[model samples]
Target: MNSRFTGRLHLPGEDGYEQARIGRVFNARRPGRRPAAVLEAVCEQDVVEGVRLAAERGWQVAVRSGGHSWAAWSVRDEALLIDLAGLHELSYDPETEIVTATPSVKGGDELNPYLGRFGRFFNGGHCPSVGIGGFLLQGGQGWNARGWGWAAENITAIDVVTADGELVRADADTNSDLFWAARGAGPGFFGIVTRFHLRTRPLPKHLAHTVHAYPLDLFDEVMTWLHGIHHTVSDLVEIVAVTQTPPGEREAVLLVTGVSMTDTPEQAAQALAPLHANPYADRALFRIEAQPTTLAEQLHNQRTANPEGHRYLVDNAWLTGTAQDVVPAMRKAFTDHPTPQTFTIWFSMAPLRELPDMAFSMQSEIYSATYVVYGDESKDAEYRAWLDEAMADLQPVTAGQYLGDSDFTNRQLRFMGDEQWARLRAIRAERDPKGLFAGYLTADEPPTNTNHWER
Candidate 1:
């Protein structure tokens, strides 16, 4: 920013810089050194300028589109922030059954309707607010995952801004290494992603959407039942457990979502009717909606309530095995420090993977559940600390972290395995040897700081 460059530089003192740097969750502590200059990248050309300038000045690089990366790695102090909000453009081809969506194209909403109109759909996250560049690259776990596959498996192509800031397309046929790594490698290891072209499949009408709430007293029982049901359900089921501990209390929502890929909602209900038999005595709150709509609507109701005004600090982890006793342990942690924040937990798993030959980071597959914790900013740090301690307590009892949700824990890194971890490290070194592109991916951290530093 202090240096004279061809690109637009909004210094820390600039008027627009502060507002532009605002993250998805306000007051949600923004870490890392603040960037001295911010590049409002309006187009591919702007991205090139920003990359070029950053490299020339030897500045750290960071990329931001939706600021949805749980780590908020998009922003940094004294580094160069390359904002991608200006590149919100989407192109859908019905004939090819593909959607080329920008980093800013809230992937679910932007392309779902088009895909629906085309009678097609893509594997995406539970939340409709998630963007393509981050979600797909981070490894998407969708509600439809019961049948299709992980969100990453469906990606067809990507347009990325490499370390030097050149716009390149990566896919099965191009930039093969980068393409394979980006499937679930996340943002920090490489450069910025401008857009993505994803494969789509035919979508069916009259899908069943359901939500069932169980009592905390029956948490263990519910988890026990869930374990047995997972192995029995039809592939048309997308289930997520919403577990929360609000300072001094414990509550849970055992959501059972069934998406009928075939006709006859009545038949789908009959198929899933066995689950309804277990009565939870007033602790049960259920919604079995059989409607003719797109996955976008189904997710919108699940992820975001009010898009215009809402602050959310989201955290993640992967839970495997059964969550029976882990629930009680989590309840204990919540009791230790109670707050009014609405903390939440998101659970997901990759059903029998299809890409046996593909080298997805080994850690990506182990987790049977992905926990996405969201809450108000007031109790942000406290809740986060509690979640970690609680998760650690459950480590001996539950599954490990989900790459999509877990932090940079050294112990967790081992989950990636020595060979796999070496491959990722080698990839980072080979692609960005100078580590110039490291800033944006983890721009919220200090220089020389490793992820999950405390751990």
Candidate 2:
């Protein structure tokens, strides 16, 4: 070990090795895979040291902040993990309505309180425990994403440590290419982001939610109706459907949830009027109550449903057609899921205001995925096969997998289009020529670039 490395470093069987390996990943399939050493960084200089050490030792580097990579990409065997758990600092400027956060401390649970004091909040994902580093970097899809757009759009600047162990600020005007590429590449990115500067919004005056539970027999009609309902509702209304077996029930049930962001209950009711008018309203098991709730409450509920320790194998895609076009395959997938814990989600979103020039190019009215959850390692192969088959069947009706959920090992298509990927690759090569970072770029022979970094 190098004395110049100022932060703590742990090897296998060491005191902190088990703790360093502890993360949000519940997937049990890759349990024994371990990092060569875990570098627990306390400061930006320590990150620079870790990168420099990896370069000197000819070892690849895996970076982790909140440690919620669906595929557990943060803990690769034989690689050095730069764990940023100690760097959780957050600050907000009320006058400017801008929030600044360190990589590890930017999860919704960590930042919501700070923002709440000023009646300001940023768009984060449904899960409160998701670290902002990976979430916002991969084009964060959050509460009312259609209304606010991808959470990445709210980011004004970032402080990043490049492959050369030099700190640089990236934004529209400075280090512009790195700024663009950083917005959506997820684990495929080339640099380690230390801090994020994001613009925040005034908290919604009122938040309301409603749920409709329908029988499985109505899957086709209900799904088709759910897909088209987005077009009729206000962008402030976000709707989702999850199909799973409720406790004590022998059959699967479809729970359609809706969130309306408005100033009053009356406005929320108006926004959700279309859903209330469903012809199958009679068929759905009756439960209709729209009540106000806080952002913290909503996020907390999402986190509780998906607690730590449960393994998750996720597969998702951007919809290419109406729900009517793809409901049969979805019905089959959900009906035969291995366990009651397994479920599918449908996020019917509004159109983006404008496409940002980043690697997260794919978009559709609906984003869909299945999360297979189980504690047993014995069924790992079965769940993996089920998810793979489901995703394969939906490929024709999907644009591509979301970058955050994408498994780089069996990558079929990318989250970005071909041109966006080419641009991202060029910038990655130019910035990190040595491939010190661990990800898809380093996993394969990296793309060649005539333009080289000024080392």
List candidate 2 stretches off by more than 4 Å.
22-31, 247-250, 441-455
Instruction: Give the per-residue lDDT digits (tens) of candidate 2, residues 1-455.
Output: 74766679988988878777754444554556688888988889899888888888888888888887777778877888899988778899878889999987755787777888898878887888788898888898888887778889888999999888898999999999989988888887888999999999887788988778898788888887777666667888888888877767777788887788888889988887777777788888855657677777778767655667777788787776766577765765655777777888888765546777876777777788888888887787888888888877776677666776666554445477778888987897898887778766324544321111211
The per-prediction tally of clashing pairs is 18, 2
Clashes of 1: 18
Model 2, poorest ten-residue lDDT window? Answer: 446-455
- Tens-digit lDDT string for candidate 1 (399-452): 334455544421232223345446666777888888887532321343222224
**CA lDDT, every model vs. true structure:** 0.59, 0.78
TM-score of 1: 0.82
Q: Global lDDT for candidate 1?
A: 0.59
Which residue runs of candidate 1 sit more than 4 Å off their true CA positions? 1-8, 23-32, 244-261, 277-297, 303-314, 322-343, 346-351, 356-359, 362-378, 407-417, 439-455
What range of 10 consecutive residues in model 1 has the weakest lDDT sum? 442-451
